[model samples]
Target: MLPSDPAAVELVTCGKIEIEGRLVDASNATLFCGISAEGVDAKCVYKPVSGERALWDFPDGTLAGREVASYLLSEAAGLHLVPPTVYRDGPFGPGMVQLWVDTKDGDDLVDVVAPRDVPAGWRRVLRAMDRFGDPAVLTHSDHPDVCLLAALDIVLNNADRKGGHVLHGTDGRVYGVDHGICLHAEPKLRTVLWGWVGERLPDEAVEALRTLRTAVRGPLGSALAEHLTRAELRALQRRLTDLLADPVFPTPSADWRAIPWPAF
Candidate 1:
């Protein structure tokens, strides 16, 4: 059984989605949907059930809770991230739901434009970076302006980052989805955003960080105090400190050194 928190939102099983027969996905849990949530809709992801043993051996409720937390934190930091649907026990156990994006087609910047070609979509991505300008805008990567959030994700130990994780909507804006791995306290940062290292954090991004840092010390921090432990909250403050101290390419700590080995 997964850990129970009265705060967790109870999600009823809306229905079941069968993927390849061996595995079944439950989409009725909430507003979120996985890639296989519908036949031929690629925007969804296969959200793992709360107690099901599968790819990652993380504790139950860990993924769902962190996704929610990551969304809230990213919002506070002024970064784009996937928000998860709150889930509690249903017929099958605790489960979180999320909207899916079709990663196979339009969302992929890789196939449409070659690395040599930073197409309009990717150019806009770069532009969004300039617009947000919040150095505290952590993702997963660590190389300054490159994959700023990606570096942040690496620090937070985010798993499940695929080419499709980033989506370019018809509105011409880029949105990130899937933040199941975060707030680990330990260093688990991993991502693929080292393309532009050594650049300065956008001015606006810095201001956003400053705002969040201050907020965390006040009402916002007090509100979160209920959701997170003192240690986890301190780690967040420390991350902000690290970013401010070295806004240009902040590196992970030595004790938490060593990237995960190649998938071979």
Candidate 2:
């Protein structure tokens, strides 16, 4: 939806990856691979079966809708999430391509599994968020950030935020990738960003969130609204309002309480 040349695009296989086998034969409709496109430096592509929702178990417009919203939210959140690339029906089926980012510079919260695994210098990143009793800032399971992501995920109906959906760039930044399940009108938030719960957000961080909340309603929101339904747009606006109302360390939501098992 964000200025793309649908004509110049083509799907090319990436040799013998196990996933490729399932995709080429059509037995496995969803294929994940890395690509370098005209505007995209390097990106992971999610190709779903044309008109098929069985892969992620949602409706057709759901995935694409969410991708657009995520891009909007990233812009709103001051996050460096690359713009989403849409994959439509070619000779093959329906798939999606989007911008890839350097996770290292992107500030990934889930690059390490354990405190010991954290780079000695970056261990503070772990300690900084240890109050919630998790090493990683984000996870497939749930952390503060993951939970926040889930809220967006559920609002969009994104069911793909499972463990594998998150990517840790070599640059030491955690990047959240799969966004096919998104932009629904539901309150289905799921993800892992709570490692910093109770930890006061710095003044700078809080200010950034404020900027995003307002930006979403500006040109960016207007631009993205073109790709979304009226209801979806309203829903996004509502969510932003709700979050902006209370951008302090202690969120008032009842869901802010405890951490799940493995994370604790």
Question: lDDT of each structure?
Answer: 0.46, 0.46
What TM-score against the true fold does each predicted structure earn? 0.59, 0.57
RMSD of each: 10.4, 8.1
Model 2 global lDDT (CA atoms, 0 to 1): 0.46
lDDT accuracy of residue 11 in candidate 1: 18
Q: Model 2 segments beyond 4 Å from truth?
A: 1-28, 33-43, 49-59, 82-84, 87-94, 99-160, 198-205, 248-264
Candidate topping lDDT = 2
**lDDT of candidate 1 over 113-167, digit per residue (tens):** 2234454323211211223453221222222233545544533455444444555
Give the per-residue lDDT of model 2 (tens digit) for 16-84. Answer: 111322334322245545554344423344555453455443454456545645755664665443344
Residue 218, candidate 2: Cα error in Å is: 3.1
TM-score of 1: 0.59
